[model samples]
Target: MQTHELIKALAADSRRTGVAMNTVWWGAVLVAIVVATTIFFALLGPRPDIAIAAQTVRFLFKFVVTIALAASAFALLRMLSRPETDPRGLLPYLVIAPALILTGVAIELIAAPAETWSSRLIGTNSLVCLTFIPLIGIGPLALLLLALRHGAPSHPALAGAIAGLAAGGIAATFYASHCTDDSPLFVATWYTIAITILALFGALGGRVAARW
Candidate 1:
């Protein structure tokens, strides 16, 4: 092939690849939000007390943590998309949400009665948390996996894990609205378990489906 023709072809291919990646990233975000919102409304809408300012803030706090985690994980997933990219730079961002939550847990422990610690930690909705989080997360996770495939990540499992974190975060945000348990103890325990379960599933799924 002529030199000019070869260069043109490479440029075209690069542009196409860039467009594809953008499509996947934005598409995944839109689909995740729409599907999660639909499920939330169809299944368990916001708690009845959501209108109250204090209750709203309480729920909003959890939403912030989960959504922040999701955003950070999404950023990490984008970084992992390139085969030669290193993920270490993005790791600290991923921990911000959890660290904030841990701080909240410490404060709650200091302020709340020791006698109520177990009850708050256990919460009334542990089983419900386990069920709804993973259930709602499945759609978003699947969408994220589909989107990640376009990037051709080197470590499929890691990419998948991050995608799962994003999905789980989105799902947990929705779940927080329905959850009556507002204590940071409850979030530290049950919410963590639910998100971990989704991450595990994402890891396993990525192992099988995220390969180049």
Candidate 2:
């Protein structure tokens, strides 16, 4: 076959089959959770704060899990009605969320008051806020990369939502380890905000990157 024909054939394959990016993405999440949970338990076994931490962890965990579930439902809809949609393109952002969260934390810390800095640097509330740093950047960056590679997904909104939720879920797992708020209320309010910011970035990324 000619070069142009070969290129066309590859594109046709990509459009025909998303190739189960969700399986790979969700597998990464499950493995991360299992490994992180086992390590945390082994290293920090039965601490007095375990009960309190579990309470808070439950809320955050549920939130993250819910996003994945919701995305799955949406994916089913897209697959049935929008066969051209390529959800797999969202996978790259899984690797981008942590970096963005770290950047956000650094920016916030530098701008914080010195007196409050020490406490905030070592406090639960502060750590919770820090989680947002990468959450915002990851989705956008992933979308950008995927666009450069595959052009745009047939349905940008669906792709964006999948990317956003996947990133949010992974970041929450890390946040659970680093922060110690021990209150479902705190996770529901603060953690939700962080994920929301990231999701918004994902949407924006899809819009901007799709244009490229």
Candidate 3:
């Protein structure tokens, strides 16, 4: 075939594939994540005191921060899904949410009593936070990795890691409702650890699953 015809054919193929991937495949994966998460939350239920305005607000704050991080990381993941796309421009922005939360943590510490700080930091639900966040995150992480397969990612592990961040963020958002600990210290410590663990899992999974 002539060069012009070959180019046209490839372009048409790319467009068709893009549409299918974006519409059908991506939508299915998103719905799966939502359904799975909703089921998990229904079975587990939010903390009993969640109706209390003060407690609910605290949980909501944590959820907002986590979702923000997930949103930014997911955006980056989408960009990285395409080969040769550099995420440098948007990468730095990922820290904004965490930085703001950490600042709040610092202020909280300064305001609280010295001895109480340790208890707040160590929160009663540390173990639960660690366990549930990753547990809930597994499905989303898998789905994100599956989505990444639709594109050509140059650095599979890195892409996977970002997907993990997105998954972790999402998991943390759901876990927040069940978590009783409202202090920023608790969130900064345990939530961060849980999210990081998922990110590591993503890295490992990416090495195997995301390989082009």
Global lDDT of each model? 0.84, 0.47, 0.79
The candidate that achieves the highest TM-score relative to the unseen native structure: 1
Worst 10 residues of 3 by lDDT: 6-15
Better of 1 and 2 by lDDT: 1
Q: Residue pairs in steric clash, candidate 3?
A: none
Rank all candidate structures by their lDDT, best first, as comma-separated numbers: 1, 3, 2
Candidate 1 TM-score, true structure as reference = 0.89
Model 2: lowest-lDDT 10 consecutive positions: 74-83
Give the local distance difference test score of model 1. Answer: 0.84
Write down the TM-score of every candidate. 0.89, 0.46, 0.85
Tens digit of lDDT per residue, candidate 3, span 41-120?
A: 76566777778844455567787788888888887887676665666766685786688688778888788998999999
lDDT tens per residue, model 2, 108-204: 5576665765454444564435544354335333632253224335555555545555455555554454455533334445665666666676667
lDDT by residue (1-212, candidate 1, tens digit) is 97556545644554578877888898888899899999988998988877773445556678778888888988888777666556777779788888989988998899999999999999899999999999899899999988877765668898898888999999998998889998888998999999989899898888777785
Find the 10 residues in a row with the least total lDDT in model 1. 6-15
Off by over 4 Å in 1: 1-16, 53-57
Decoy 3 TM-score against native: 0.85
